[model samples]
Target: MKKLLLVLAALLVAACAHAPAQSAKEAGAKTERNFSPAHVKEVIVKGKTTQKEILAKIGTPNSVKRRSLGVTTGPAEVWNYWTAPPLNDVAKGGLQPVTSLAVVFDDNGVVQDYAAADSSVLIQ
Candidate 1:
């Protein structure tokens, strides 16, 4: 029984070794989505856009958090939508592209500020 298990494990490893590697474009495709940073920014208007508008344009966020903006501003709500490389790809080493959007809203539920980032390009 032990020998049979060992043979099966060895075969599995051999198969994996012969598997073709994923192309760079294929890796990026894994993280790419319908919406992008520019799309999010276009849909959102700081101090003008409301939470409902954001939901209508971009759909639900991946996460929501509440925190203090400053001593004067008190608290605010933040919505984040993130698309990052898979953990398995990162585990293999090297930088992986990440695209995300964060929207901050005041107590009135109107967008106060927003930022988007894409790590596909490196700045000089």
Candidate 2:
């Protein structure tokens, strides 16, 4: 009876370990949906871009904020993108993936300084 109990306990531990790992992988895949680095680069690197052009190309940003032009901060426009958690696994702890792209426009409303948030979260 002792040996049988020990064997059963070992099997239960092994099964539990494998179960949690699959959940982690599923969480990671859920986060991957909203992240698109390629799309971000394409919009920023191109020459002579206007706000209207950016809107047309990438569609509407997730959010936007405006700032005044200054020495350290010449005109600021922030754009955000996000992906929600998967529907079936709502109980699991998963972050809503978010990326922000900031575009500073010159007086003429052309892109002056374009910056993107560090995408390390998505890469992992």
Candidate 3:
């Protein structure tokens, strides 16, 4: 009976210790950040940059997603960057100043296209 009680206690401790680290890692995966348009433009080059280059230029991604394209179009990847602080409005949520940039890459891992909105891109 004492041995059985000891085993049960060990199991309880193991379960409690196992899950919190995984949850914490998931929580840190998404980042609400202010990215600079100039910095992005300087590092990103269409038909030239690769995934490794991107990681070298920018730090960890807020998140990463995989996408599949049809056979003819070829698979593509998209990365998102925000040029302003993340906002959570209590009421009347509206855009005051925000910038978003997306970089697309073909299966070759070369930058294929990019798009940016807002005057933030005008910054040098």
TM-score to true structure, per model: 0.56, 0.46, 0.50
Off by over 4 Å in 1: 1-35, 68-72, 91-93, 120-124
* Per-residue alpha-carbon lDDT of candidate 2 for residues 16-114, written as tens digits (9 for 90 to 100): 434123366555544332225567677665348887876656544555566654545555555544433332323332333435565666556677766
The order by descending TM-score is 1, 3, 2
Which candidate leads in lDDT? 1
Q: List the residue pairs that clash in candidate 2.
A: 69-75
lDDT of each candidate versus the true structure: 0.66, 0.51, 0.57
**Residue range 9-68, candidate 1, lDDT tens digits:** 545644443424567985555543434777876788778999988876775576778874
Give the TM-score comparing model 1 with the true structure, all chains together.
0.56
Q: Evaluate model 3: give its TM-score.
A: 0.50
| Candidate 2 lDDT score at position 14 | 43
